[model samples]
Target: MTLIYAMPGNELFAELLMQHTGYGRAGLSVHSFPDGETRVTVDTPLKGEQAVLVCSLDRPDPKLWPLAVAASTLRELGARRVILVAAYLAYMRQDARFHPGEAISAKLLGEWLDNHFDALVTVDPHLHRYHSLNQIYSRDARLVHAAGALAAWIASHVERPLLVGPDDESRQWVEAIANLLCAPSVIARKERHGDREVTIHLPELGRWLDHTPVLLDDIIASGQTMLQTLRSVCAYTTPKPVCAAVHGVFAEGALDALRGEGVGDIATTNSIATETAHIDISMQVAEALTAVCNIITERRWG
Candidate 1:
């Protein structure tokens, strides 16, 4: 069973779930009171069935009370099992303590959500150094990378190109794409200050400069790093690079910032829908859900 809440920015996701699981297996609705409190009503029954809740924990909605309440209620509604699909998990940047008395928000969030679901799944969680979310959840958490979908999208349109990793954190994603395309790649470094300022350091591209550069990053919050890197590479390289990311948080005027920076093209996965999200990550997410469902099914009957 699939329980869907009518959250903004999740219509495409809900539709994808329906496409993958068939219409009759899903339920969706939302209820709000006059005093501002909200409630989620699963329009169809979920009793005795494994229920998967599809929600993207994006900005403004990440701390939404109704979603949490809905999650807890699903298990109580006779759902034999509950799984959460946080398409774009927020508060993940604060995974570790960087200051005195500061909360490790990711750890707290992960632990708080641990007991609510039999499994947790997300697409391209903004984990800086961590590749797998199991390290954070310490249980049944799946971090689904959008690489295959991203690669397929690129292959359909892009020609032979050089893949560039925007920073050390993006090496895994960049290398994976490079391997998929059998193309050359390189990694760069950046010093970020707040959400709007960044200084990018690009390494010697050598012969790779002849090929078009496709800069890839996991997230683009303020678009500063991408803009700065694009300018730096354009100034020094022969053929300029296009830019893409898994999540286009694109806070504030980030998209305009990219345009003003003279980026020829920009693409990001639909983890957060934007005019620039030229690619979608749903197929990758569907594959992940299939794997988790299989595991949960096997473990239950094994």
Candidate 2:
């Protein structure tokens, strides 16, 4: 068993973690410094105990500071082992060299955290074609695919839903979710030149588009891709609802931007705690962690 802790930056995340852990003891405290920095303290005794720090890596700049401090302090407090549960992991998109001299930020972030934690757990991490978080982080890093949960939620709410992937990259998720719900799926072609601009193309689906549709994606950093897909689909078909695994990273004015585009309702798995986030994928996250923890325990103690 491990001691679970959460930060003020993500109190709801902490509560969810506690519920999932089924561990009666949960502890956390965070304070802001005069210099605008933050400090966190774990009041419970962590000596020689396994500790699970649950934090959603939303806006990295603000959350990173406290996360670093908390990890270091917990390590110093004699925690025998530390596991990080990041509901949303940032800086994972830069897995490849898009241009010359571009730093592989995802690699750096993974390596940095690799030195601190025993295991990493994240839900629906944005992975590129060439790399994965497990390859980036040396320790056991579990990428929890929430497609099943998302599919189940959609099935419970909507009947005969069509899953639409915003782009080719999201087709994997779209297909997985559709399979889970026993539904059909399609992926749009997306073209992007730079930030804040995108083009999505969807081939005609005719009567299939007339039914309830649920747009799905692994990440929604800027919401541009989704808006483009929504517009493209809406242009030729009837209005359909949209939902995603990770919602509303809502970068910039993405929320308003998407709403302005006539997006009916949006839901996400609490990967980044947005207003559109109506669901929590903590249970899914916990299940992934449990699997990883089991493997590690077997390998270490076998």
Candidate 3:
């Protein structure tokens, strides 16, 4: 098997994956024309070998065409199978149409990738309405959890940690981490008025006043939820709440906004490359990839 990656700030992740899986590395060179056209080149032969493409679809629009070209080119280069390891799968929020004539981008992107890759692996995709990745994707799809790593980080770093979920949607993540650490957990009631405006009703934390509150969530896109929760927690307590997430999609100065709002600390998994990626989830992802490769190998030999 060979790993091929194309993106800035992904070299470290690629190196970690290579070290963990002992997979050969393949080079991919991308050139962009003045007219905004792109040319993708795979610099290594992949004939009779499984090709794994490592890409995190954070800002996915500009990378889509090149990814498509690369995946198709891998098949033409005689790759036995092409597997996609998308650390942070995008367009998952639009799993369903909220309004009439709305396009379901999640399903569309899933179908598009399904047509290209023989298998897919991603970490903590935004699966709101969709129960599983298999519901949207046709290929062999796997979703790896980052909660264990996050929980371990919290247990080691934070003193007397009190896991707090911003809203009901975050209950699963909070409970998982809290249970792992054997700590108390609380969930805030959230009412979304708009994309930027949200009302968070936090549960009473007086019982665990000595414990440091750590707000946990799956994805932090707009930061509205975190901001609201931070303000509410601050109003009632002295210790500033630390905010952490699996995928830190800090969109449009959201990180700045969180910092400005006096959030104690902000950190996230290395799903998308950002300054706040203090916790490493590369081992988790590499383990999943190894498992997937083992399964594929067993099936091929069986």
Candidate 4:
């Protein structure tokens, strides 16, 4: 098996995966023409061997065409199997149409990926209504959680940490981390008026006043929820709360806004490459890939 990274500036993750899988690394070179056309080249031999493409779909729009071309090109080059390790799978929130004539983007993207790759693996995708990836994808799709990694990081870093969920949607993640650390947890009631405006009602935590509040969520897209929760919590507490997420999809000025709101610290897993990516979830992803590889090997031999 060989691993090929789709984009540049991802050598660190590729190196970690190489160490985990004991697989040789392949290169993919991309160039853009004056007419805004992209040309992708496979720089290594992959004939008759399994090839895995490591690409995180954070800012996925620009990378989609190149990725599609690369995947198809690999097959044309005689690669036996192609697997996609998308650390942060995008377009997962639009599982259903909110209005008439609206396209189900999640299902559409899944169909596109299914036609390209033999198998897929991702970490903590933004699944709202869809129960499983199999519901949307036809191929072998695996979802890996980064809760254990995030929980361990919280256990070592924060003192007297009180796990907090910005809204009911975040209860599962907050509770899981709280259980791992044997700490108290709280959930805030959220009412969204718009994309940028949200009202958060934090529960009374006078009993756990001594504990430092750490707001936990799966994904932070606009930072509105975190900001509102921070303001609500700080109104009664003196200690500035820490904000943590599994996927930090911090939009423009989102992180800065959080810091401006008196958030003590910010951290997230390396699912999406960002400056606040302090926790490494590569081991967890590599373990999932190892399981997939084992299953493939078994089927081939059995």
Candidate 5:
């Protein structure tokens, strides 16, 4: 039997997984001390069952220790195996040291996960520098693309959407979503000066002026890239632009900031929980988990 256990913030997502997988309910208790230390307790017997641990590593600092302890505790409690299903994998942005004495966080965190969990399953991770998760994670690390879920949401709502990509890096998935929706797409040029400072050079959108402009990016952390792109597109089209992203890590007041700049609609996958997270990626993740479970059952760990 597969049993699903959720870390503190991941309970709702785990419940969805349980519904799809028809997996039995299991629990994990988290207690934080006055000294900023964490205590993790597995609440049920996990002997000989595939223990699926749900912990979306968004704000990962506070949750890391609990996750580590929980995984270890599950193993100690006689779980046959431990699999991590993170809706959003964190610490993937920094793959190298750009300056002196900078830590390669992606590499380090990947190694840490390998040491703690037997397998990993997560939605789209930032892979600009690294080609694949295999480059970093040696275990059964799987990628569940959020494009299908994003496309599904778009198809249901907007009748006409001119898909807009923030950069060349976003081309692959944005194009996939566009194809699924059978919509015309364009790529914008982005020049990033700093974290919040970005300029987007949009192509002449006069031809597609009638269609609703949908700006799609893998992440919208600061929301600056989409903000600039929306403003540029607004110059040509009268229709209010729609912002679509996989992970809505709206840093600070990025959501309100985007709304302030006249974004008509904002939709993001539930990779990171937000009021803007209207698009649900749990079905996609559940499907991926079924495949992962099959592999684990077959003892395929490469």
Candidate 6:
């Protein structure tokens, strides 16, 4: 049988996945040493079972050793396969070395993870430069998109919504959601001044001025683009803007800053497990995991 094991902090989402996929449950424990090393113990016996580890790779520095050792321990315990279901896969943005002597993290981390895990499943990795994850991963890496879940939420929560993308990169998500809901969408242009500073340019609201504007993005890192966009959006007479993203990596007060700018509603998938993670993507994730095991299942927050 396929057993679902949730790394620390992933229990709730993993339970949802287990319920949806009819998968069995497993356990894991970790202990940190004073010297900064980690000890992991697999609590469930799985002599010949496939294991799925739900560990979202956000703020992944401290979690890496626990994850690697857990996977290794599972293998040592005779797990047939150990699949990593990292809903918010990190280190994807740095696809290449922007400067000299820089470590290409995407490749470097991919190799590390590839060696540790049998397969990879994640949702909405920030793949702006490369075509697919296969370039970096040697394992059977699967990607799932959360646009359907976002569109469904918009269709239910808002009326006459106007989907707004932060920049050219968000066109894929904006277009998908717009098409799904049959709503008008517009893409804005963004200029980055620094990590926490950005300038956003939006087209004239024009005839679609009356529609409720929904600010959509794949990731909300420092919230600069979304903040500047929210400021620009507020300048108009449009309804209070709503924010939706697959990964809610609201780095240090980004959510409050948006609220300060008069945001109407903020919803993100449980990829990063924040207060605003109202949208559910567990069923989608279960579907993806089941598919690999020949089980039928459906942003899955890959």
TM-score per candidate, in order?
A: 0.89, 0.92, 0.96, 0.96, 0.96, 0.95
Winner of 1 and 2 under TM-score: 2
Each candidate: what lDDT?
0.76, 0.77, 0.86, 0.86, 0.88, 0.87
On a 0 to 100 scale, what is the lDDT of residue 246 in model 4?
Answer: 94
lDDT (0-100) at residue 160 of candidate 6?
Answer: 94
The sequence of per-residue lDDT tens digits that candidate 6 reaches over residues 40-69 is: 888655677788988998888999989998
Q: Which ten residues in a row have the lowest lDDT in candidate 5?
A: 38-47
* Residue 116 displacement (Å), model 6: 0.9
Model 4 RMSD to the real structure?
Answer: 1.3
Model 5, global lDDT: 0.88
lDDT of 1 by residue, 193-295 (tens): 8666778998987776577788888888877778887887787667646888898888888888778866668888887767877887777677777788778
Q: Give the worst 10-residue stretch by lDDT in candidate 1.
A: 1-10
Candidate 4 stretches with Cα past 4 Å from truth are none
Candidate 4 clashing pairs? none
Per-residue lDDT tens digits for candidate 4, residues 187-282, read 999999988999999889898887889999998999999999998888777777999999999989899999998888899998888999999988
Candidate 2 structure quality by residue, lDDT tens digits, 96-142: 78889999988888888887789999887778754667788888888
- Supply candidate 5's per-residue lDDT for 143: 92
Give per-residue lDDT, candidate 3, residue 140.
80
Best by lDDT: 5
lDDT of 3 at 300: 86
